[model samples]
Target: MADLKQGSASHQHEAAAVIQKHFRRYQAQKRYKQQQSATSTIQQHASRFLARRQAARDNEQEQRAARFQAVMSRHHERIQQLELEKRAIKQLGAGELEAWQARREAAATTIQAHWRGSRQRQQLKLSHPALATLRPVACSSPQPADEPSCSTRPISSKVPSNHPLLHSVTAAGVTGLHAEPSTASVAAWPAHRAGLEQQPSSASVCSGVGYSSRAAAMHGALRGEASSCLSAEASRLSAVGAAAQQPADAPRRTAALPAARRMVLERQVQLRTDAFKAAPNALAAARATQQESDQRLVHLLEQHTAAAAERLKAAQRRQKLLQDAEALHSQLQQLPQLSQLPDNVTGAHFALPGACGARAQRSRQAHALALAEAKVGSKWWLPLKALNQQLRDAAAAAEQDAGSTSGSASKAAAGALWGAAGSTGLLQQDWQQQELMWKDSWQRIREEEQQRPGLQELMQQDQALRPHVVIEQELSSESSWHAASMQ
Candidate 1:
């Protein structure tokens, strides 16, 4: 039994040794795996750290390059701007700059001068000369010391019958066809003669007869008193021919006058006789022309006055129409509930039976009246049409909803509210008032048209006369009498 126990103990000891040996081997293998893992983790951490450092350096290099490029671009743009400025400064010289400035100033001055001259000419045409004073100068001889200076002489209230001006006034009878000057008068013989020399006779006549008459008076005075009568007779005959002659012929005429006074007088008498023979026909034609012009002027004045009155009437009518429309709009705006009604009337609240029917009837009536009003030509036509359309649409929707669902409590309540609003008679009253206003406007417009002249009459009168009338040039009664005597 001892021997068996010893063997068993030895087997147990060997089994324990083997088991312990396997356990040590397993522990060593786990330790080796742990060490390898630790080495690999250290290697990976070092590689990752190196990679992060390299990426950071690369990013810094890229950023520096981008910043350098940005700096270079900015510097390039600044340098270009500086170079362009330098070139521009070099291109513009002092003399050229001054010349450009001078041209600008000259152009401005020329434009200003042109406008000023036009304004001055307009002013001269509008100006009325209250008095004309002429200072005469003796062309043939110097005046004696005892004679009064023409400049110092007081203006005469009336032209004297024996005045030298009479001869010329009679010679050039056409000169008298001007608005008579005021009471003040003075002899400005030399200035008048100078003006006659400078200006064409036709232009002078158109400018003012006062100037022409004064010029004629100076011309008669220059011929001397001894030959004044003969010269005056000759002047009447030659006046027309003289006016027609060029300014260059004036010197020649003046030079020849001293050599052949009698021959000139005879020729003038013959011319005067011939002019007298033709005077009746010319006078008849002028009278006919003047009559036609007077008729035309009257017609044109009537047409213009009628047109202005019509325009005024039209403007008044438009204003009245606008006022009526605004009043109607105001009445509509006052009904807040009606205006607030939904586009789809099925959503409206009514509380009683037949309420929807009543509301629909009122809406239809309002819509009908609005539609009628829209037919009128007014600025409010579109708005009125829109309002009427909305009412019609709401009425239609209500009718459709009532047909689709005959017993909706909410719809009945909405219809009751609309009916209550209509039953108050406010909407009907507003409509009646608007209708009355429209009728009154129409009546007023009709009355105005009735009181004014008919378009046909005005059109006929316009067609018979000219659309535009020009005033006929007529000689004054005094001038006509003088012309008859000369003829």
Candidate 2:
């Protein structure tokens, strides 16, 4: 009975173990079915949520589009209004009649002054030095009896035969029934004697022996009467005396007196003085005319400048107004238009596409799909974990078959990671080589620094960077491991 009982107990224990195993499998299956149902429900919910969100986004987009269209239309209208106002302002800017008149008057004044100055210069050049004495005076002073007639104009000394003054003076000088003076006789006057005795001098009294002493001698000789002849006579005495005693107020007389002769004589001294007096007045008048011309020119330049300035200011003002109008139009255009224009909405079109919120939704979808895929085969984390373990084992395994075929693909993927590990060893070798080279270079630099001023300071710079090499190596190895696991 005891043997039978023990056997039964063992059998019962085996049965119970079988039952527990079946129950655990059933529970796992049930859990899997529930997870699948939950996943389906989540997918359904996600699809509906995406549809709703897409519709809302589409609606918001439609509203935005409507607002944009309204804003553009209002902006265009405002631009038209501003254009009309600008045209009216332009009309008001025209018709400056007073300004035009001022410009014309100023131009005329400048032209007249320029002409006057030109005429004065021409007159100055044409008038001979001796003839300058004959110029008219605009004002006058009372004349003494001793003064030559102010009206007497100077004529050419060597008058041409056809000259009008020649005939008048010739007939007058010869009116008393005497032979006309020959040109040779007038020219025979001693030039050297004229030069020496031109001014009052003691030698002025001297005369040649055959010359008459007085005018009576010359008159008697001419009339064939000896009583009128004399050894010497004052040369041109009566002509000089008549010239000297002429009234300054006498009427204008066109005379043929030699200008050169009168210039050298004492007779026409008052005329020369009057000409000198008038010269300054003429020059002053010319200067005044020039000044007036300059003023007019400046005024015209100012007008032109003012006009240009006004145009620039107007352009700037217009530019500012246009900018302001554009900004306002943009603002007015941007004001919500969906609220203002609902009729523009078309048939059931999604206002916004799912693309707007696709990132989070797609991520959720991906998670769902990954979960389903994991149930069918293995979890993403399991494969990745296996792959990482295989790669690590392959990296460390001394026996070829330990991870050979098992992690071959994983090893290929982890080649960069293993290469980085190997590169760390290579980096250690490279660092050792670099350290040797640097030590030698540093010694050379130190020697050079000993010979050169300030080199020590340069070499000592960035002295804090030495320990970073170890830190970078550790970080690089850690990054490589993390990256390999992720892959």
Q: Top TM-score: which candidate number?
A: 1
TM-score, per-candidate, Cα-based: 0.22, 0.20
Query: What lDDT would each prediction earn against the true structure?
Result: 0.48, 0.47
- Expressed as tens digits, the lDDT of each residue in 1-487 for candidate 2 is 4444655575576566446456645766776797677767766766786799799999999999999999999999999999997787666634665676679999997787666656644555343232332433221455443344333334333334664334444554532323333444444544433663555332222122122133222223233332210111124433443444578786753243454434423222333333344445566666777799999999999999999999999999999999998788556434332224343332222122243332433343344333333332322233223333434454445234446565554445335443322322332243345445634654664485367544234335424543574476457666766776797
Q: How far out, in Å, is residue 339 in model 1?
A: 14
- Model 2 regions more than 4 Å off: 1-120, 123-273, 329-335, 338-487
lDDT of 2 at 338: 24
Give me the displacement of residue 94 in model 1, in angstroms.
60
lDDT of 1 by residue, 1-487 (tens): 4444655575576566446456645755765696677767766766786799799999999999999999999999999999998898679999987898799999997787666656644432223111122223223444333222122222222334554433443575533333322212112333444554564443244234323332343333333221223334334334324433437646443221221333333333333333334445555666677799999999999999999999999999999999998788557434333325444332112222242654655564454343333233333233333443444455446656777565354355444534433432332245545556756775675586567565556446545643232111122334555765797
Task: Give the best candidate by lDDT.
Answer: 1
The C-alpha local distance difference test score for the whole of candidate 2 amounts to 0.47
Q: Please give the RMSD of candidate 2 to the true structure.
A: 31.1
